[model samples]
Target chain A: MSAVDTRVPQPTTPTPPSPRRMGPDARRVTARTVRYTLLFLFLVFVLIPVYVLLVTSFKPGTEATLTGAWDLPQNWTLDAWREAWDALSPSLWRSFAIAIPASIVSAILGSMNGFVFSRWRFPGSDIVFTLFLFGMFIPYQAVMIPLRQLTSDLGLASGVPTLIVVHIAYGIPICSLIFRGYYSTTIPNELVEAGRVDGAGLIRTYALIVLPLSAPGFVVTLIWQFTSVWNDFLFAIFLSNTRNGPVTIALNALAGGQLTDYAASMAGALIASFPTLIVYIVLGRWFIGGLMAGSLKT
Target chain B: MRSRIRNWGPGLLMVAPSIVVIAVFVYVLIGATVNESLTDRHTAAPAENYVGLENYANLLDDDRFIHSLKNLAVLTVVFVTGTLVLGVLWAFLLEKGVKGEGFFRSAYLFPMAVSFVASGVVWRWLLNSAEGEGAGGLNALFGMAGLDVLQNPWWSHPDWGMAAMAVPAIWQLSGYVMALFLAGFRGIPNELREAARVDGASEAQLYRHVLFPQLSPVALTALIIIGHMSMKMFDLIMAVSGAQYLTEVPAVYMWQALLTNDYAKAAAIAIVLLVVVAVLVVPYLIHNARTERQR
Candidate 1:
C-alpha cells in the first residue's frame, strides 16, 4: 500500500501548473468553492420544478400566464387547485381504492415468499427465484394483450379486484426480489436455525422472527409498488372502464388530448404528485437504505 | 413423525400462496399468449383457429412494427452507452471523496424517485418548439443568449427529436448507474490503487489497467439491467411523444396493436419481444450458470 503518501490536489478547474503542488489555503478555497457551487446548482435543479408546480397550482390560469410558469403569483388563488381536485376526485378515489390494497397484498405475499426462499435450501429454490427474476425482465407490454383477453374471458374486465390481481401478479417480481435478497443477507441463518432448535414451528418462526425482521425492506417495496400502481396510465386505461380507471388514466383523459390545457393540467399533475413525493421525502432514508442494502453489502 | 409433519407443513403452506400466484399469473398467462398468437382473436371473444405463421408474417411486414424495432434498437444503444459511460465517470469522481458528497449523491439520485409523468412534462417544456417566442425553457435561455438553433421546430429527424427525448432519461438514470458502480468501486480494496500509484502509474493508467478489470462483473450486471430497461421503455416515449407511431418504440406499438383489435398481431409482437429478450438473457443465464459451477 505504499502509494504516494502525497495528498495530491486534483485539478478542480483550469489552473496554471505550479510544481504540481499548492498551499493548504489554496486547496481549501478551491475545494470549498467547487463543493458549494455544485450543491447550489443541484439544489436549484431539483427545487425549481417543485417551486414551479406549487406556485402555478395555486394561481388561476390567467395569473399563471401573466406571471410566467417560473414566476411568483401576485394572487394566491386556490381556484386551479379546486378545479384540479374536482376533476381528479374520481381517479383519486379509484387509485386509493385499488392501489392501496394492491400494495399491501403484494407486500405481504412477497414478504412471505422471501421467508420461504430464505429459510429453505430446497433443491428447486434457486430455480424458483430465478423464475421470479425472469418475470422482472419480462416487460408487462409483452403480455398486456393476452392478459386482457384472459381477464375478459374470466369475465372480470372492469373491476377493481381484477386490477388488484394484476398488480399483485406483476408486483411480485421486484418486491420478492428485494425481500429475498434482504432476508438472505440481513436475517442471519443462525437465527432461523436457533428458532428451529428451540422447537419453534415454521409459522411461529416466521411470524416471530422473519416477518418482523424484514419489515423495513417490505415497507420500501410497498411504498415503491404503491407509487407505481397509482401512477400507471397504460394498463389502468386499457384494463378498466372509465368508472374504475385510476387517477393517472383519469388525469390523462382530463388533458383531453390537447396541449392548450397544460397549465391547469400541470396543476392537476402537481396534486397527483403530492402523496408519492411526500412519501419519498419523509422516507428518503429508509427507501434508499433498502435499495442500497443489497447492492452495498457486496 | 407427526411432529415432523407439523414443522414441515407450515413452511410449505406459507410458500404455497406465492407459488400459486406466480403460476397463475406468469406461467398461465404465458401459455395463453402463446395460444393466442396462433389464433385470430378479438376483444369481444377469442377466435381460436390455428392460423399458423400468418400473424408472425403480418406482424413483421407491418411498417409500424419494423419502425418500432429500429427505434428501440437505437434508443437502447444510445441510452445504455450514455448511461454506463457517465455512470462510471461519476462513480470515479465520487471516488475522489470530495466534500458535500451526501448532498450531491441525493441530488443526483432524486430524479430516479420522481414519476415519469413529471419528468415527461419537464422535457416537453424544455424541448417544445411550438411557442413562437421561444417559450420553451431551453429555447428561452437560448433566446437570451441570441442563439437561434433552439428556434428550429424540427421534430421528425431521429437525431434531434429522439436525442432531445433522451436527455432526461439519461440524467435520471446516470446517478442510478453511478450508485451501482460505486458499490463495485468500494469493493475494490484501497491497496490495489495505492500499489498502482506507487508504481508511478497515472490515474488514467490505474483505471484502464486496474479498475476496469476489477469492475468487469459489476459492469456486466449494470449493462444487463440497462439493456432490459431500455428494451421495454414506453412511458417516457409516450409522455414526451404521443401519436407519432413511426417514432414510437415496440412497447407502444404493441399497445396500438391492442387498440386496433388485432389480438393475434399483438400476441405475435409480444412473442417477438420475448424472443428478443431471450436472445439477450438466455446466453446471460447460461454464462452465469457456467461461472457458478466453475466456482
Candidate 2:
C-alpha cells in the first residue's frame, strides 16, 4: 500500500563502497554512464512527438510542412495559436462546462457513497461495491446504443448537459472507488465510531467529520474525473456535434478534416490538451495517486 | 432485526444514487442492448421484431467483422506487450536511481495527460509513409540517421497497420505501466533483496530470481488494464485511421453501423464487446473482492 504513494523517489543513504564483490571505481562509473545514457535515449524517444508538436505549432504555415516537422520554426508566429483558439475556444469552454460540474457532482456523490460503503457498511456491501467496481471496467460501446437512445428519449441529446449527465452516470464507479479506498484507508473507524458516539449519523458524520478530511480524496477524484471528461471523445462525438461538442470533438474536426492546416491542427491538439496537461502538471502527485487508487484496489 | 434495519436504512439511502446510476446505465442498459441485439431493429424506425440469433449469425460470416477481430488481436497483443516491456524497463531504470528522476518520470508521463484524439493527430503526421525526399516525421529522422531500412509505411502498412497503431498506444500508456511497476518495486521489502545479495546473487540474478517474480501481480494488473483498454480502443483508431478497414476494430465497426442506423447489428457488436470484456474483467474483480475481504 505504501508503494502506492509513488511520488518522487526519495534519495536514499548511499551504501559504503565495497570494491571486492562489486567492481572497482571505473567499472561502476561506466555502468552509471550506461544507465544514464539509456535513460537519455528513452527520454529522447518519448519526447520526439512532443518536439514535433511544439515546433510545428510555433511555425508559420509555410514552414510547418511535415518534411520539416523536426525543424525549429523559421518564422515563429502566433497565427496558428490564434487560428486554433478561434476554432476551438467555444468547444473548450463547453468542455469546462461539462467537466467542472460533472467532476464536482460525481465527487460529491462519490464521497457519500464512499463514506457509506467504507465505514457504514450494511450486509452485502462488499458485493454491492464489487458490482459498482465492475461498472468501471465496462466497454462504453456496449452501453452506447442504449445510452444514446435513453438520452434522446429524455430530450437530452446533442448538448453539454447530456454529456455531463452521461459522464456523471459513468463516473460513479471510479470516483466512488477512489473515495471509498481513500476513506477506508485514511479515515479510521475510530473517527466514525467517535462521531457515532457523539450522536453523529451517516449524513452528519460525513458532513461534519468525514467531509473535512476528504480534501485529498476530493482532489484525486476531481482531477481524475475532470481529466477523463475533458479528454472524452467517444461520448462527445456521440452525444454532441460540431455545434456544441467538447474540445476533443472540435480538435478532431480541426485535425481530421481534409484541409490540413498543419500548424493550426498542431496548435489545436496542444490547445485541446492544455487543461488536462495543466491539471497533470500542477496536481501531478495526486493525479498519479488517483490513477493508481482507481485501478489497484489494495 | 428492527435495529439492524434502522442501522442499514441510512447507509442504503446514502449509496442509493450510485446503485441506481450503475443499475440503469450499466446493468440495465447492457440488458437492453442484449435485448436489442436479439431483435430486428435495423433502421431508426420504431418497428422491431424478434430475430433471435440472426445478427450474431450474420457476424459469423461477416468478413469485415472477422478482419476487425484480427486487427483487434494484433493491436491488443502488440500494445499490451510493448507497454509492459517498456514500462518495466523504464521502471527498473528509475528504480536504479537515475539523475533527475523526477523530470524523467514526468516527461514520460505527460503524454497520459494528452487525449488520444490530440496525440493521434500528431502521430498520424509522425507515421506518414512517404519515402525519399517526401519522407517526413519519423521517416525523415530515420533517413537523417541513415536508417533508411527502418523507414517504412507505419500505420498505412497493409499487413501490420494495426501493429503500427499500437506504437502510439504504447507511447501513451507505457508511462502508466512504468508508474505501476515503480510502485510494485517500491512495495517489495528491502530485506528480501539484501538476503538475496548475501547469498551471492549477481545483480542480474537478483532481478531475475528475486525481483521479477514478486512483480507478477503488478504485471497482471497492467496486462488486464492494457488489455481492456486495447479492447475498447475507438477514439485513437478513429482519429488516426479514419475508419480505414486496415486498422478498423469492433468498436469502430459498431460506430460505423450506428451511423447507418443499423441498430441491431450495432447492438450485436456491442454485446460481443461487452461479453469479451466481461470474460476478461469479471474474474479479476471477483478475485480482487475475495482478496480484499481476506485482508
Candidate 3:
C-alpha cells in the first residue's frame, strides 16, 4: 500500500550540461529544526491509529482496561489472534473465492481489450474504448439496483458469484486502462508491423509478441485488482447471503449495533490483514513502481 | 462487400470479447438500473411500470437517505483531502531520505494490505468507549500517566468517530501516496536542488518554489486516484458503524435497499453515486486518455 513516488525521468534521460552547485543555508539551521519538529509530530499523529491497533490486538481485555493505550503490552497473549482466526477464516476464504477469479477474468478480458486498442485501429474502436474509459466514472450505487436483480435472475444470488460479478465489472475499466496504456508504450509499432509482414495474424501476434511484452503491467494490474476486490465489502454483503460473504461482512457482523465482541473482533482483523502485508514484504516495489511508470506513460 | 468484411474482421476478433463481457455484466446492467429508478417496484421481480421518478422524489425527502448523502459529502471532503495531504507529505519524507526509510515505509504500508475489515476491527478497539472497548491500551497507559485527553470517548462520540474512521483509511492510503511522491521526487534533477542551494534558498523555500511545482503532475495523479478511492469508501465506514443494516454510506444504503425489498430506491442511490463519480472520473480519465495518446 505504499504509494510509489515516481515522476517523469526528465533529469536522467536527457543529458544536461554540468551546472554550478548551491550550498545549504547555514542561517536557516534553527528554522529548519523547527520545521523538522513539526513534520515529525505530524508523522507521529499519522502513526497513532496503527499503534492503537497493534497494542489493542495484544492486550488482554483486563489489561486493556487497566493500562494506557500507548504502553507496550503488560500481558500479551496469542489468544486474540487465535480467536480472530477461528472467527474469520471462513469469511476470508469466501472473499478470496470470489475476488481471485473476478480479478483474473477482468485481467484476461482487459488484457485482450488493451492489446486490440494498442495494436489494431478499427472503425468503432475509439468509441468502444471511450465507453470502457467511461466505465471508470461509474459509481457502484448507480449499478447496484439492476445488478442485484440481475444476480438473482442468473441464480448467482447469495454467494461468491454475486461478489465475483460485482468485482469483475468494476475491475474491467481500470484494468483495461492500465493494460492498454502499458501496451501503447512497451509494444512498439515496428514489432507489430513486422509481425504483420511475416503473415502472423492478429491473434498470432498477440499470443507471441504483445502478451509477453505486457506481462509486467499485467502482473502489476492483477495485484492491484486483487487488493481492491478483496477489500471491497458492499456487494458481498448486499448480493450474497451471509454464508458466502467476505471477511469484511463477518468483521462487521461482530458488532451487533451497540455491542461488539472485542477480542474476537481484533483477532479476525489481524488475520484478514495478512495478505496485503505479505504482498508488501515480497512484491512491494515492483507493484507500485510498475503502476506509476506504466500509468504515467500517458 | 469483401473489403467491408475484412475491415470489420479484426475488430470482431479483437474487440468482441471485451465488448460482450462489459455489455452483459456492466453496460446493460447499468441501463437496467436507470430504468428501475423510474419505478417503485419491489420484491422478487422488477414490475417495470413507469412510476415517473416517484422513487427519486421520495428519495429526495427520505430522512435517512438525506442524512447519508450529507454525511457522504462530508466524508468525501475529509477523505480526499486527508489522504492527499498526509499521503503527499509522507511521499516527501520517504523521498527526502530521512533515517530508517525502508523500515518506516514498510511500517506505514502494512495497514494497506490487511483487509479494511481487519483494520476496522483493530481501530474499533483503539477508539471504542471506556464502557465499550475501554481505555484499554493507550488510554490505560496514557490515562494512568496523566494524559487524560487520550481517554476521551474517541470512537463513541459521533463526530470524533468519523475522524477516527478516517484514521485507518489515511493510514492505509498514506504509504501508497508516499511511494508515489517518492518516485516523482526522485525524477527531479539534482542540479535543481543544488542551484537553489547556490541561490541561498532555504530548504523550505527550495521545496516551496522548486520541488513543489515539478511535482504538480504527480500530485494531480494522486488526487484523482484518492478521489475514486474516497468515492468507493464503504468498507471502512461499514466497519465503523457496524454494517449495512446499521450505518448507511451510499453503497451500503443501496445494499440495504436490496436486502429490505427496496430495489428501486437502491438503484436510484447507485445511479446517483455513478453520476457523482462521473463528475470526477470523466475529466481525469479523459486526461489520462489524452496523455496516453501523446505518449
Candidate 4:
C-alpha cells in the first residue's frame, strides 16, 4: 500500500495528516495510535531477551524456575549473580587486562600508520595501506592453525601478550583506515607544511602537530578496538587455556553445561557484558559512528 | 640524496612495525596455511610435502564438511533475510519519527554491544526445548498463554534446528544492519522527498522508485557484512548449541579438526572459509578503493 495515499492530501512536514481524510482530528488519532503501537511492539521485541537475562539473574534459581519467564521475581535474590561473579570475575579481570593494553597499543600504532598514509604519503603507501586493508577480511579461521603453530613455537601459546599482539596485528587495518580518514579531513597539509617550514623533522612534526590534533580519532579507534578485542571469543578460545582465558570463554563455559543453570548463566552473561555495554551506553553515538566509518567508506 | 633518504626514513619507520606485523601475521600466515592445506597431515605431525590439491579433493568426499557447507548455506539465507527485513523495517519506522526516538534507537542498538556469547546464553535459556513443567522462556510464555500446542523443539528439533540458530544471529546483528540503514535514510535530503511529492508520487512509489535505488549501496554493504559474519560464525553456535554437527558451520568444523590435529583437513576448511569470505568482501574492498581513488 502507498504510505501516502494519492486520494488523501499529505502534510508538508513528516507530522502525518491527510486533509482529504474524514477529519484532521481522526487522522491524527489514527496516526498516533498506529505509531505508538508499532514502537511499543518493537521496543518489547528488542528488550525481551535483555529483560529475561536481568530478571532471571536477579531471581533465585528456584524462583526463576517457579515463576513465569516474564514475571518479576517475588523474592529477588542476588545469589545467582554473586555466584556467577565469583566464578567469572577472574576471567573478567583477565579480559580487562588483555583488552585495554591491546586497544591502546593498536590505536597508537594505527595513528602513526594513519599519519604516514594520509599526511606523509610516500611512494607505494597506497599499496601498503591496501595490503593492510585485506587483513581486515582474511577470516581468522584461515590464519589460526599457522598462527597457533607460530605462537607455540615462539613460546607464546596461551600467553595474554600473544593475544594482545594478535589483536593489534588484526586491529591495524580498520584503525588505520579510520584514523587516515579522520586526519585526511581534519588536519590539512598546510599545517604539516607549516611545521616543516619551521625546520621540524618528520617525527617532530608528527609528535607536536599530528599527535596533539588526534584525540577524537584516537577515541573512535580505541572504542572500536577495545570492543572487538573484549568481545572476541574465537581467538580467545583457540589461543588461551582456561586459566588464562578471557571472560567470553569463561561465560561460554558457564553456560555450556548439561543441567542448564539458567539463572547463573544469565547472571554470568550480564556480568561479562558490562564493560562493552557501559562503553555503548556512555558513548553510543561515537560507537555507531565508528561502525559506519569502518564499513561505509564509500 | 642523503637528505632525501633521511626524509623518507621517518615515515617508513612510523609504519614499519605495522607493515612487519601484517606481513608476518596475515600474508606469511596465509601462505603457510595454503602450504599446510596442500600437504598430508593425517599423521601425528603434519607432512611438509605438496600433494597437489588432495585436501581440496578430499573435502569433496568428506560428508561432514559438505554437510557443514549445507548448514552454512541454510544459516546464510535465514540470517541474511531476517537481518535485512527486520533492519530495513526498523529503519523505516524510525525514519517516520517517533517520540523518544533516541531511547528507541539506543534500545535497538544495545543488543549489538552485548557479545554473541552473552546473547547465546540468554537465547539458549529462552529457546530451551524442554516440554511441560520443565519448559522455560518462550516455551513457558506459550504454555502460560494456554498455547501448549504452539511450543516446538526450538534448537533441539533435528530438522529445523539449524533455522532456529538464526534467532540468536538475527538478534545480535540485525541492530547493526538497522544502524547502517538508518544512516543511509538520514543521508537522503528532504528536498528529494519534497520533489517526489510535488511530482504527484505516492510515498510508496517514491520509496520504491527513488529512495531504494539510493540505498542500494548501503543494502549491498549490509549484505556483505552479514554474509561474512554468518559464514564464519563460531562463538554463537558454540555457546548456544555446542558443536551439534547438525548446526556445525565451517568455522566450528575447522576448530574441531584443529583440536584433533587434523592439520590438513583443518587447513582445507580454513582455506575454503577464506575464499568464501574473500568472495563476499573483495568486491566491496575493490569498489571502496576505486571510489577513494576517484575522490
State the weakest 10-residue window (summed lDDT) of model 4 chain A: A1-10
What's the TM-score of each model vs. the native? 0.86, 0.95, 0.84, 0.92
| Superposition TM-score, candidate 3 onto the true structure | 0.84
Instruction: Identify the runs in model 3 with alpha carbons over 4 angstroms from their true place.
Output: A1-76, A155-157, A255-259, A290-298, B1-8, B42-48, B129-164, B189-205, B243-248
Candidate 2 retains true contacts at a fraction of 0.77
DockQ scores for all the models shown?
0.40, 0.60, 0.41, 0.55
- Candidate 4 docking quality: incorrect, acceptable, medium or high: medium
Deviating ranges (above 4 Å) for candidate 2: A1-22, A197-199
lDDT of 3 by residue, A98-150 (tens): 87898898888778888777677677676678787776656666666667667
Indicate whether candidate 1 or candidate 2 has the larger DockQ.
2
State, as a TM-score between 0 and 1, how close model 1 is to the true structure. 0.86
lDDT, candidate 2, at B55? 96
Per-model chain B TM-scores are 0.88, 0.97, 0.87, 0.92
Worst 10 residues of 1 chain A by lDDT: A1-10
- Each prediction's total of clashing residue pairs, residues at least 3 apart in sequence or on different chains, is 0, 0, 43, 0
Clash pairs for candidate 4: none
- Candidate 4 error regions (>4 Å): A1-29, A66-68, A193-199, B1-9, B131-134, B146-150
